[model samples]
Target: MSGEVADPKPGKAQRRRLSRSLVIIALSIIAGYLIIQFVGQIDWGQVYRSFGHVSWWQVLILVGVLVLRQTLNAVPLATFVPGLGLNHSLQNDVAANVAGTVTPPPGDVVVRIAMFNSWNVNPVDGMAGVTMNMLNFYAVRLLAPVVGLVLFTVAGLERHRVGWALLCALGAVVLMLILAMVLRAEDWADRLGRGAALQAQRFKASADPDKWSAAVNKFREQMSDGFTQRSTISMLALLAMVAVDSMILLLALRFVGVPASALSIVLVIGTFFSAYPLTAMPLFGFGVLDAVLTAAFVEESGLHYEPIIIAGLAIWRAITILGPLLAGAVTILVWRRRSGSNLNLWGSKDTAPTLSEA
Candidate 1:
């Protein structure tokens, strides 16, 4: 009777909170960028030319690498929790997880939860595991920009745009704050959803409040246990994902007939930090991606973006927006036929068994 509520309809305030988060990120990046462009003596030609390249094969490889990056995410995700009735096959989860990663609203979260739910796991408990996994993910991601910031400064990348370095640092700090919230989530979830709290502790007997309290303690303990067990694997998987992400852009660079050095790949991916550029969120890295990637590489590596920018950005858009959308559509059709009905979100079954003697 204790679990996080499975996808409670967001209240108006929750929607506002989500929107505000996006706005803050967007404005900070945009405003900072404009200042650098105008006040900071940025090379407007470099900014403009970064997008005009053409290399179809390299672009194809780039798309493949992006898809591969998403696939790598599945490794840690599936490995994160143990003994949950994971409904889908490992292949399916990886494909869906990849598709999920290309778009967001935490639709990635939805895909993962559904995979578990299909196995008869309670939705709420699955939700908590998924939530915790994301908390871990964001915590890891915070490293991207922080590392970028320090590297950029030491390596003189900041000479091109102090604003860019600052934005990366800001994102890292925000992610750190989110990580803290995730660590102490149950304490906060207690306030957000009494219903969620009940579902989180689905192992206790008697359906009593006291039982729920005790089970909540156990739930947190189990979560910590899972983290400790998988920390090494999780960290490795994440690093692999990041590597795959960098390679995708490298693929794009190749497509544009440009050969990027090891260090250049590091900076472009760092500035363009997120994997989900196709999300509906306004700040979801849409207008900024092509520009910053081209500019950053040019600034650091003395590369020309004219041909690279056009071809590379085109391929990125195709895979991120079209590829995943098509895959998800296929998943929907197959899942419907199999389940004999449309299953929108996934979850696990949660039922309290009679208290077993300790």
Candidate 2:
């Protein structure tokens, strides 16, 4: 009887792990499918034909600009996270952002992993904290564009999609705002979760985390003053970071053979991210970004749907998705070498000894 019981336990554990893995794989596959379908819809032959039409120098400039946009992508994350002082170098962190953007699952995963390696600090609340940050991000994003779109609609600029645009932007803004409130309302979230868990505990009689909760409260209190003290700094940094993202959109379009109109590109990005959140997938990013830009530009700017902008969007997507992965791999590779021995993932001299010593 004991042997049979033990066998089922192992079997059940294996099944649980398998199920989790399958779920992750399924989500990844779906993301990949959407990306492919979107990009495949683009006429690659047309893109290549347009590619041949552009001057070599213009092409090179576009590529270089794209790289800069990728490199700068991390500024907003650094601004919003609200830890670490102004003295920190932004270089490698930029690379980390590039990696996260390059990798799947909101690109923040890559950023977080690289952060763990570099800083050795395991963030509490994990994805919940990230979701909180996203709340701040899209809340600002949805509003700015929304104001612009509403004005445009009121002015009777758009022929159609005005209601759709307003509804999409408004809905996204509301969603992001709710998430932000939920995230910032940390006590409320925890209390609700704790209540549910406690109810379950009555059925199963679980170990209490009251002590841990106490410790967390203490830590939060300790941090709150510092956060408040630097709230202005943090918020300004955040604003700049968002500006960087907006600028990147403009720059990427310039590189991609799209017209370099700031207002137009911003509106396009505003519309897409406002409406479609899931388009930020790794495999699907290039295609989705293309659609976003295409939707915005073709409608607003009266630009023809030549595939160069699509290619540029592809390049922009590459910077965010593939660039950081490549950078992280390279950093790891170099860390495995003798000369880079003193550096740690956190970039502290004390923790990582030289590879030669190892």
Name the best candidate (by lDDT): 1
lDDT of 2 by residue, 205-244 (tens): 7735564344445334433443433333433444454445
Count of clashes, each model: 30, 15
Residue 317 in candidate 2, Cα distance off native in Å: 1.4
Instruction: Tell me, by TM-score, which candidate is best.
Output: 1
lDDT score of residue 348 within candidate 2: 24
Give the local distance difference test score of model 1: 0.53
Note the Cα lDDT for every prediction shown: 0.53, 0.47
lDDT of 1 by residue, 1-358 (tens): 5796755554544567667767867775675466335323444465345555544665566666766766666555456555552334333454455535443344455554555555555545555555555655655565555545554566666433446445645765685454344345766433334444556558543345555555555555555554555655665676677657666656665555556563365466555553322222353455555555555555554534443444555556666556655666676567647756543433222221212310
How does model 2 score by TM-score?
0.56
